[model samples]
Target chain A: MTCKECRKRFVEARYGELNAGQRAEFEAHLQGCAACAAEYRRLQQTLRIMDQREQPRLESDFGDAFWDKLAAKLDAEDAPPAPRPPQRETPARVLRMFDWPRASRIAAAAAVLVIGVLIGRYFFSRGGEEIPLAGSRETLLQPTALEVRAGDYLEKSKVLLLGLVNWEAETPEAVALDFPRYQRASRDLLQEAGYLKTALEDSRQRRLRALVADLEVVLLQIANLEAENDLSAIEMVKTGVDRRGILLKINLEEIRRAQSLPRPGQTSGKPSI
Target chain B: MKDEKELIERAQRGEMGAFRELVERYQKTVYFLALDLCGCRQDAEDISQEVFLKAYRFLPNFRGEARLSSWLYRITVNCFMDTRRKTQLQTLSLHNDAPGENHPPELSLPDPGADPSAPARSHELQQLIRRALGRLSPRERSVFVLRHYQELPLKEIGEMLEIAEGTVKALLFRAIKRLQKELAIYQAEV
Candidate 1:
């Protein structure tokens, strides 16, 4: 192809608008034409040369003076001042009702008032010197024998509750026949008979009632085991309480209430059962 | 005083100050392009002012689909083209004094001076190229400046000039051919 024809197609090809067949034909011609090829190379170099010329850039801050002039013109065009809207009073007024320290003082005063009322009721209700719950001799004696008997019963009951809670059968009487631990514990605790009767009647001492109810179930199981000679039932009862976390619950509540109820001689140690 | 987007928004809202701010920001660049395209300081300033005023009036109509610079470039080129159409240049022929080859004006050595060229041999050649540029058609001159001098992508030139990409490429090719002819004359003389 002639240089003129090649140049015409070259422009079309450069823009990627030439159809595939036309482009192929141009490529084939360029492969064989020296003069057209040379012109094509020169045109590419010229493009390269032009592309190398950087846009003449001034500083980014070049137009500050011109901007100032424009700004002055704009500001001059603002409308004449009009009456402004009347401001409404602020609506969120709770924050203003009390200063920080005043709020703190009111809370402290209420707390002191409550404490005073409690202290007054405690002192005024008593006929004599208000005795310390820990040091009162009579208070100490009231629950000691009862707790000792309850503790013995609880040991056996703890095992039985463990079994019941775990859905295990009662420890068998045959096993009790061999393992005499329950009978021995019951015998040793028989001296606390008087307090047991009193504890059973008192509804005010709900914690004690809960403990007794747990023990009564264990005692019945023990009696049933001995009568039936069911050794398997005894072992089952023992496993139930352990699996159910029953003893831990009753023991924890009993110790808390028992410690609060004064003992005659025993000084409270570290606030325990 | 204001950012570009803020100025554009305010101008769109019919604020003259905002439009003027944009004009101030771009005046020098428009001026330089006009001077380069028209080959005279007076013509360049007139083209630059006209471009800005037209841009201000058209601010509300600008769709903001392209960069503000691209939009401004469109205005500048269009204004130049209008002027060129009014005063159609006659394509001047040169004596083939020298016939060997060198680079085109776009590829000529960089001009570090504020003036178009320094007192150097290459500078004289640059002056000759600038004169030759004035003779080309407005479309050809624009394509040359954008493709080579502005180093704009062909697609961008198409967008600014509102022409097809193929047309831009063709015009660029023709402009380069014209430049090569003028350079060939210089080469033969050298």
Candidate 2:
């Protein structure tokens, strides 16, 4: 056998990975040739040296220090946030005047009612014409609500995209100044985007599904940013957002003002618009 | 083995003492694995901690599909890969040192006693091996470290890596060939 063939077999043989026939041939070649024999010995010696190389030992206090530090970190993470001081109570009259939550809820309910009525009118106008319902009864029955939710997602996505696009990194510090905000927003959006994408997987609104899928990709990139101060990563995320044309695709400002907002009920601390 | 299973179960149930026990059990092995993979003590320490923390976070989802040790090994591998990637990116901007120049500053030869030259030579060989390992791609380096240093079987390595056994063998073959080439000079000297 050639020296090259023998050397190839030697590696497997050294590890006892070769079968009987291959091992026998490798052994025969090693016995026949002085050069191959010398090479085999050298290989064995090298492996022995490698195997004997000592792994560096940690300091004796390493375990204690690691446990202490990690425990502190976990403690900090697990601690509940300090309660905000109670605001001075306003007069009952003033409180009623500025009950934004109640007003917003009422407005939201009315908007949904209007959308339902408009959708009913449109379907009635269409008479017997079949509305392609994406083969789902939920979509067929609640198309208006789904459209509103889609619009809300689109608007939120635009806000994130615009934040990235409008970020002016005049100084090095400025480059990653808003990355934490971007990362949080992207993570929040990613969860929603994943759900929407799956929900729209069989939907007939091809354009909306495609846009959501692309948006998910950008959100994932943003969410996986390794460090808060990584400017290059921020730029990469911005580039991804820009490349997907997420802001331009849906005209989110117009959609937000035109469509009734669908609230998915404060998911993952994300604010509803 | 039953004791280990119980420990994992307790740790999964948010028992910090049980988790600490798990950490104490595998700390040295994980630390050494990280140290070997990273070639830097600080990074190794960080990676080791990250691995344990990640294991804790994801433990409830563990479902006991693989051995706890294997799962921890997988986490160590992933954390090392992530740490290496970040280090490489930072190195691009902050440092221009040669490969393997990031060897742990504390890596000095152990006491030589009478044969000073022997310890120095062994240290040199170790550094050479580190440099050779640094030459490997991340995937190849992980495969090589797990096979050679960790001494995991090919099938287990495949399971840990979530790749086919044939792929593991192929990667192992490639890694060995590359290491052999890198250590060829030592082969000739020997």
Candidate 3:
């Protein structure tokens, strides 16, 4: 080989990693060539000196000092890391002192607000459409059939609720109405309805249960008034019936509107209600 | 060995004391290796600190299949390489002995300026070799340092570098060739 090839092999040889035959050939070449021999000697000397060079030493206190400083910084960072707690944990507890006396009182207030909202929305969305009265020239009177149907819906709801709660000892017929046995079952069905106002699944069962719960509440109020034998209680019942009658009308309209919307299996564009 | 394993297990459980012990025991090796890779003392110190900090952060994920030193070295090398890439600063100046006319005995080498066999130049020549090493690519410098100066076996160097043995060999060969070229120039200058 040439001088460059020999020098390359010589470099490899300096590490004592050359193969035996190559080492022999390299030795012969080194004996013959003064420059290669001199180069080999110098390279060996460099390698030996490198072996003797001291590894760098760090400051003796580096670890302790570093940890001390780092720990202090980390401690400072961690001191106040937690955020303020949110107020949502016990919502009922928070509102306890400021709220209505009982669940029923809250329910009655909510019912009033809901009824007021529905009435206002209905008037606003109507845009003054002329609704003629029966046997009169009044341009904004509701139909008598609608009025009768509204009364029937409320009356039926009262009967159903009486059946739902088995409201009185005398109401054996209401108790025999195949009423729902558990409030939890009704709650689960209500959950599936997607709203208190409608049922999207098992509509027959949901409707029956909802109608029963409503009727039971009304009947329970009547029974309480009758048991007390108080005329003032009768007036309270009258007010409840009047307000509930209007809600039943609005709810029936909403139920009609919902039923008219496209159902899963029916192709008809019209509502069954 | 079981003590190390138990310590690692405790460290994995978020035990700060156990982790600190691990750091204290291994800090010297980590710092020296960092210094070897990055010639700047400050960069070495920084890399060493980062390696320990990162080890603590990733402690729970350590599976204990490999020695902690090997795993730590892997992280250290990555951290050093990342810093080197970001700075693009070569680290030759760290080895430039603190400037003084005073020379130590074991380190002396021949000086062409003085007697033909002058010993001071030998140490200076060794320093020159180290300085010229900075001109090499990090991979070449790494392979050269690990193979020659560190006297690490090629296979272990391959493991530390995460490269195939043949590739390490090729890189080491190229590095030696470059060093020889630089050394030849230095010899002529002398």
Candidate 4:
């Protein structure tokens, strides 16, 4: 490539989006030209310096408080807060209404089960129809939706935290880091991690469970990173991630999951959720 | 917890929770983007609030032709630009714009060179780089920040800004050139 052509492709080259042939030509041009090489090095160094700077601190309840403040502002203007979400009745909340002893709850459940069975038998006899088991059967044949969700959660967290888990204060320029992006992703993943942890509470995925719990602590640390230089906090988080080998575990689980994916018309010997 | 598409759909239906979720998802993206373009955290926060409020109001009409993040980003840039224009006009109002009146000198802006006692912090390049970023136009700053800080593709940034990829490239090139000039002093010290 000519010097002009090579210089024009710097953006693409810096982002590693150039095709192999183009990349090869660009590298060759840089190698042969001292001016081009120096310019390229300075560009890379500029980005590295950007990376080393601390991320701007955001309030923990920033989103929540913004919504409330906006709502109040609108209310003062006599414009009611935009339509509120429909209140959802959580199953746990519904169950809490019963507030009965375990024995009494079990007895009630048994009575309901007997009554349901009798009604089902009556329907089966009268309609002479088999129960529709297809939906449940299909779900059993595949992995729990939770596994897929867990996999996705783990994959995202792994990508987001990899830079953070590996960052060392002594070698701050080791990677082209984006502290703000990591902080945001960690905040998003924090909710998913908690949900997944609770969903996996009764499951057979022990390693997956532990990994997610570890991810929670690490992600929390990342999401709450203060504005100032808090190298000690980052180091503690890094140490926790390393001690738990969370990244390695995520990779291993992914491999395990890939190997265990059920083929068409076949089901693996996987525990049902 | 919901996918972005679902969140938008629900938020459009006047669901506060869904709108909140949507905001949570892209809140920082919008905040930092504003911060980079404006070079001030307080302005960034105001811009973000305005962007989200506009999203909440006009969401029912936000046809899903574009990604929600891109739409929000476009709103952020527009909000920043509008705020900047108003501030500029307010500042300029102090001067005479009638017919052929001479403009008054800017007395509000303190000169950096006026304070020699201010430690140079020659070892610190971050402050210098941050100040240099303030010299860029809104479009140039957005292009550079989205490309580098957000790691967005050039085409994606162009689409978000409603500019052609070539224009994005030109803007980014100019921005980097400016930064390179600023960083030269630091490089010389090394």
**DockQ of each candidate relative to the true complex:** 0.13, 0.20, 0.08, 0.15
Residue lDDT tens for model 3, B1-190: 3499999999899788887889888988887677666655567778888888788778899998878987887787788789878985445432334455123322122322444563765557656655556546778877777678656667777898889977887787776656666566665664
Worst 10 residues of 1 chain A by lDDT: A169-178
lDDT of 3 by residue, A1-273 (tens): 556677877545876777899898899888888898887787665555446544543456778987886566556655887776766657776677454545444454444444434433432245664122222342321333333333334443333332222222232221221222223222322232222222212333454345534444544565444333344654565566566663464366557645645677868744344
Query: Candidate 1 lDDT, tens digit per residue, A67-95?
Result: 55444544544546677786555655555
User: Model 2 segments beyond 4 Å from truth?
Assistant: A1-11, A19-42, A81-273, B89-118
Candidate 1: RMSD over Cα atoms?
Answer: 31.0
True contacts kept of each: 0.25, 0.23, 0.09, 0.32
Which regions in candidate 1 have their CA more than 4 angstroms from the true location? A1-6, A12-32, A45-273, B1-4, B15-17, B85-119, B162-164, B188-190
Per-model clash counts, in order, read 33, 0, 11, 0
Off by over 4 Å in 3: A1-43, A69-273, B90-129, B184-190
Cα lDDT for residue A94, model 1?
A: 55
Cα misplacement distance, residue A147 of candidate 4 (Å): 94
- Lowest lDDT block of 10, candidate 2 chain B: B88-97
Which candidate achieves the best DockQ against the true structure? Answer: 2
Candidate 4, superposed: residue stretches over 4 Å from native: A76-273, B89-124
Displacement of residue B25 (Cα, Å) in model 4 is 2.5
Which is the better candidate, 1 or 2, if ranked by DockQ?
Answer: 2
- The lDDT for every candidate, in the order shown, is 0.59, 0.70, 0.58, 0.71
Per-candidate TM-scores read 0.43, 0.52, 0.45, 0.50
Candidates by DockQ, descending order: 2, 4, 1, 3
